[model samples]
Target: MVVVKSVSRHADVASATSELHMESGQIIRYVAPMTLDCAEMNEHQQVVMLAQEKRLLFGDVSEEAEKWAGVSDLCQAMDHIVEIEKETELFKGKRILEVGFCTGLPSVYALEHGAVEATLVCTDNDALNNYIKPTIRKNNVGKLVNYITCDIEQLREKFETNKFDIILAPELVNTKPEYFEQMHDMLKLALAHNGMIFFSGRTHYNSCDGSMSAMLDLMKSKKCFDIMERSTFNNSVRNETAPRKVVQLMHKMC
Candidate 1:
């Protein structure tokens, strides 16, 4: 049994608790919806809640989603990981750095499956810091993980060249669609020879302007990484609002 130390932020915020039962005989605790009334929620929170409620009517979050406290279209991300895992031997005893660690489950999943370590890159938010600390502890894999509260640009500067064996980047397009080329350069400096980068992106009607094919083409044109594998799927469970996501696995061309 894992005990989460109560944090001062949780007491201040209008937070609630939700439980996810995992297949590994563990109970993962996540922040349930905030206790705020509908009228009190910000526009983004309200929009996310409405979409989540719609998805709930179709199906509950999956086992992989349980690892991350039900954030985003994680099941589809896991499906993409599954495809890559079968084709490559990259996880075992390899060093991983994950940018956009929304809940940190992808890192956790990689560690649990035999990766040597996972460094989660994130912004320094009090609530999220409090949340991931316990989530890592709860999995009893805390020793295999590291957290850096900063953007990828700043985080890359602190690491040595060829330091990471695998890099996990999710939701980069939604974060900064214009900066893919710059981001690729920074990540390339930190990746080891033959290192792999797993990047996931999403696009929906009238929401995001780029298609998966276009994004892939742009990566190739940048001339840093060669595509290894690519997968796309409709994420109806976690993303009822934006149902399409693209997952790309790439490695240094040189």
Candidate 2:
């Protein structure tokens, strides 16, 4: 026999009270929040109780789960950005451009961290206006962000040359080879003379045989940008063991 006590908040707890009799002779009480109905609360409680039993039957893997949770590409990118800010104050009062703004998290982070403004460019307007916009609004940085929906090739027509102080492309280099040419063009047209581009991607995806190397080669051949810093860190998310690399490139001086 197992005994588990579960507490839940509900708008009308008095009316939403329920009891569950498990096969293991466990009595689980569902305390509903003001927002949840009695039936919903009962169903929710069953899930919670089942999870608790599962952890009891099998050892809890919360620590292991947490260790991997912070190992995602997005998490790695955010950590790298934080490191850049600490070393260079890169986002302070800068005009930021974040390419591939799937979640728009980089732009939102920049605005909250001291960036004056950020322009988020992505091909998907639905995600920009729906998911990312709501989060920006919740962060109260809606006024500091501008959204642009277009492919990388259209960047020149969308903005004037030398418009951004820092261009962030988190995990942008892991794309198809054809996009690298367009990315190089965007860098030439959008980045200020002294501006920098900071991007990160998995090591395997950014090295030889990958599009990132090709992109860097293009920039170097053009004599338009110089690699400022490159570093790599290991990540073990989703069973992927490859190290992720972060690179910083600055516009070359004439």
Q: If scored against the real structure, what TM-score would every candidate get?
A: 0.64, 0.61
- Give residue 142's error in model 2 in angstroms: 0.2
lDDT of 1 by residue, 1-254 (tens): 11112233345332445444332332334442222121223656546655554553455433223223223333234434554445435478889887743566566667766789988776857535556665576567888888778666566677654378878766555434576566666677777786777765544223335444556677778776667544333334234454434355556555
True lDDT of residue 80, candidate 1? 40
Q: Worst ten-residue run, lDDT, model 1?
A: 32-41
Give the C-alpha miss distance for residue 217 in model 1, angstroms.
Answer: 3.7
Q: Number of clashing pairs, model 1?
A: 0
Clashing residue pairs in candidate 2, if any?
9-33, 10-32, 10-33, 10-34, 11-33, 11-34, 11-35, 12-34
The CA lDDT at 95 in model 1 is 93
lDDT (tens digit, per residue) of candidate 2 on 1-254: 11234334333432343433322232223222112111222555656535543453344523222111212233234434465444437578999887732455566666755899988776765545444566566567878888787654466776674389888776665566677777777766888778887776543331223444566677778887788544433323222333445578887777
List ranges where model 1 is wrong by over 4 Å: 1-76, 79-90, 150-153, 205-214, 228-242
Report the C-alpha displacement of residue 212, candidate 1, in angstroms: 4.6
The global Cα lDDT (0 to 1) of model 2 is: 0.54
